[model samples]
Target: MEDRKLTVRSVERALDILLCFTRNDDLGLTEIAVQIGLHKSTVHRLLSTLEERGFVIRDAATEKYRLGMKIWELSTHLSRSDDPAILLLPAMERVRDHLGETVSLYLREGKERLRIQAVQSNQAIRRVAQVGARLPLYVGASSKVLVAFASTEEQEALLNDPEWPSWIDRVSYMEQLYEIRECGYAMSFEEREPGAAAISVPIANCHGVVTAALSVSGPVNRLSIDTLYEYAPYLMEAAHDMGLMIQ
Candidate 1:
């Protein structure tokens, strides 16, 4: 029992060392030791083990430690897991039930947006979101939200792509993306599909990086632009809840 307790404590200290890099990209051994209230020698030993396991890297010049590629690789696996879908479903359902509209979780796939999960409304005339459906990232509310929060290089790549729809005015769309970023949401009516309307907000991970778009959508007749605006707070709250589950 004593040995098991010691093992757990060591594991906890190692995790603390890794978490120290969350606020600053890189940290010196003394900095980590001070932050976590551990002795320098103990911190060095733990960092050495972490570096060997590929969870941290030491810069030779400054001798500061930063997160290694293995962390990013593990994160990619987590993103691909079913955990996010399962964890976020309840929040999506809450929004769907409250608004009587379909709620969808969209992840960006290159120049397209894929519906990874959805909870459809029970209404007789409701918008149906088919999971695994890939739609262009150039027209709909969710699409715009994804693009708006995407990295600058990603936005430029999509804008310069030859497949960009000719009907979309690049300058105007750029302006809209700016607005979406400033307002923290996006809305569309009869843009992607006629008679369809949607309001979407960005879903950010623990690191504050936008990972997906959460949307509430329905037929235009039932979800007019004004009604969608009123529903924004609910959708935003649900999206924030879902984001908390990403990590």
Candidate 2:
């Protein structure tokens, strides 16, 4: 009766055991088996494997099981540039309210960039970015930040890609990356879309790797250097908070 084509039973049962502990701080072997409608022996076997891998930890005194730091470690890496919309959407909404501009979360894909998340301004007319919108990594505030923090090999390959001419010469590009690294952000003014401007800050993981970018964008008149600089701290703070949530 099981749908073997679409599901793997052992993995499903293991996940079930994991989910049981979510509602209860810790669960005994019998309780987990009861919760998942599985036999005690089966649940114990699954927990043995999980505990061995550090996915779950068993209390020495009580023998009850709880999620482990391994879960946190895996979750940290799982918070990719495009995923974790639940955390990113609300954070970006806060940024939009503070800056009165559209806030976007961008991720890199090969030589291109994608706006995976966004919160648009309430104004009748404001800069807007549809989720999953693609842009060139060589332009735009978010794109530049993603590129500036990209892995060296990725940066090299993108810089040399022939689909588009280099945005800047290698010497200047390197210098710009250094500047962005020092400043902890990047900005663009009417560089991509006419009359639009944006500023972006990097979101780094606990490992200090830049994984995503948070950007505020609007009409050039409103998103000026002064305004963007003013919101830079808030943007950076939001990015940091979001990063911590991943860990």
Candidate 3:
């Protein structure tokens, strides 16, 4: 009974401390203790242990604590889950051949999306995103489709958070999301990078839940909006085929 009580309290306190960081911009031990109703000495001990484990770090100048790199390391590992990638590659290859554009696969890691695999087009010019790059889910066509299709609670949870650094205009993201749902694919023209364009379709499993997105991208000169629009049908078809394989 004593051990059970300690375990419950320990979990409650740890969750409280993590939640406390969301309320303030940056927090010191005293601030955390006051907010979480823990003693300052206890807060200090927990913070030091978290820091040693690389889950939190101290600011040199301000002496405040914030999230640490260990989170990113873990995120990278989780983003590259192999089963989806293996199933998606053949369809990506088919779409690459049909559109003659660079094709990519993306999956969500927390609130961010990571590019897990890509195949470059054999064109004279190409636009490239590295395999392991992380991008905000609120931006870019592919990421937005993934976000838009998520449960309303999950969507609001991300949008309502006060800690998001790069603020995406909420209205525009909503508009783009509507378009993605209507068209069964997402399209963007150099929104993230000027002079480039992208078209993406979300791939779903047998249950019709989106598991990943496949996108094709290239430079404006070669990949005009008209060309992208023409490719959208093919992109959706490829995604459907890939989803069947993955499911």
Q: In lDDT terms, which candidate is top?
A: 1
For every candidate in turn, the CA RMSD to the true structure comes to: 15.3, 13.9, 7.1
lDDT of 3 at 59: 98
Which pairs of residues clash in candidate 1, taking residues 3 or more apart in a chain or in different chains? Answer: none
Q: Which ten residues in a row have the lowest lDDT in candidate 2?
A: 79-88
Tens digits of per-residue lDDT for model 2 on 145-233? 99889889888887777875754788887788889988999999998999999999999977787888988889987877998888888
> Residues 93-171, candidate 3, lDDT per residue (tens digit)?
8878878889999987788888888988888778876786778776677887888777888887888777554457777
Candidate number with greatest TM-score: 1
lDDT of 3: 0.80
Stretches of model 1 off by over 4 angstroms after superposition: 1-82
For model 2, the stretches where C-alpha displacement exceeds 4 angstroms are: 1-82
* TM-score of every candidate: 0.67, 0.65, 0.66
- Name the 10 consecutive residues with the lowest summed lDDT in model 1: 75-84
Write the residue-wise lDDT of candidate 1 on 1-247 in tens digits.
Answer: 9999999999999999997874578999999999999999999999999999999999999999999999988967774444667788878888877888998999998888988899999999988898868888998999999999998999998998999888889899999999999988999999888899999999998778899999988899988878987888877877887787787
TM-score (C-alpha, index-matched) for candidate 1: 0.67
